[model samples]
Target: MTQHLHTQADLDRALGELTLRDPRLAPLLALTGMPALRRREPGFAGLASTICGQQLSTHAAAAIWARLSAAVTPLDAERIRRARTDRLGRLGLSAAKIRTLKAIAGEVMKGHLDLDELAGAPADEAHARLIALHGIGPWTADIYLLFCLGHGDAWPAGDLAVQEAIRIAFVLPTRPGTKETIALGDAWRPWRGAAAHLFWAYYKLAKAPGFAAAPALAPVEAGTEPATKPARNPNADRRSRPEAKPAASERLKRAKP
Candidate 1:
């Protein structure tokens, strides 16, 4: 977790390998394409973004963040720490999220977390530190690692979309909770974060059936042709398979967003 940034190829290779093995997850692995590990500098902005994004729709999180950013001159750690709840709320945040944001800001202010240290910390250590805060949890921590820290292996099963995506795509009769999801995601190791990214991309595809459901492909490998596969059977605990569960790689989660 010491933040060994993953290159686009690193992510692509990991995703491609996972896609080929898991028929249910293949399309998603294909759709998201690949992104070079994006490093959002750690500390106030990073923490704030993680909290604000929790459980909110991607569009909703973006809207709120835009407002928050506009409301503050230099929306950095100090500013967020001093800003009043009303100010942040007006910018677009629920009461809970505002509190969560403040808690994170307070930690930053108190020096409980050194932004520099987090940037350098590996995935688990960084996650352990983040969750020490009032509201940070596996889901939130996972998101931060995946997006902010750019920890290649970070994965969050708590994410509803991930759970939902897994449920529908894999045809899982039941949705996996944190423990179960963690257990299930084990095989995606070293690229679990990429898998999460893939799922989001896959969700975009599965939203609509047929053409609308199809995700924009990134050109299949040479000699490959497009074909559909059956959804994953979430009910079938793939846990027993040769693949082990992913280490749940400490990270963050979003409730519904």
Candidate 2:
């Protein structure tokens, strides 16, 4: 049976098991406190929201999502499939995103992708099914599983923030790439989603101005940078990076359907 972190208690329980499984993470939990369970609506709206937030800052993504949500009545797959590309463009979606959303809507309508059922599927299987759809990548699929469906084992190995946090916490010489990150997550097993939450919390705290390094770990240098830049995504918007802030329009230009 698949585990789901659908509530705060569920996440806390997973964190407990995770800390016991990997004692190194205990210090991280101590420093970060209990990470909150952040969830989105399930199904089409949830997945669509994740798509809108891709490669954009929190404010930018939220702004566009607000526009899209307000403009589209109901915001269901049927409505999205029927909506014109131009109309969606005026709502701040890039041409590529518009195509992607429509394609997803079509898939949902055809009953080829069952978003709700994915919550019950094994993490790897769910991830595979989601990525099989047009415009859905590893990051997007894992984000949906972890945040939307609350799958306990869904690990977002491609997330730059998680990669950086792991590098810092493990005191690695360099940030791990996606494949390396995925391999590193093997030990975490079913609690990888909880680990992702912990790492994201750690990343935020570590990135705060004048934040002192934890005594349990090596001192993080002031203004320290990741050892490598994130690899660019040609098919979709790159995930948000701490060092780079390209205009959303520029990112859209690079995104292909």
Best candidate (score: TM-score) = 2
Residue pairs with backbone atoms closer than 3 Å in model 2 (clashes): none
10 residues in a row with least lDDT, candidate 1 = 248-257
User: What overall lDDT, based on C-alpha atoms, would model 2 receive against the true structure?
Assistant: 0.79
Point out where model 1 deviates above 4 Å.
Answer: 1-7, 17-42, 211-257
For residues 41-158, what per-residue lDDT tens digits would candidate 2 score against the true structure? 8899999999998899999999999999999978999999999889999989999899999999999999988888888887877887788789988899999999999999888989
- Give lDDT: candidate 2, residue 200: 98
Estimate the TM-score for candidate 2: 0.83
Name the top lDDT candidate.
2
Q: How well does candidate 1 match the true structure in TM-score terms?
A: 0.69
Q: After superposition, how far is residue 70 of candidate 2 from its true place, in Å?
A: 0.7
Residues 23-120, model 1: lDDT tens digits: 44565554555634555645577768778888788899989888887888677867877889887878889888878877766777887777667656
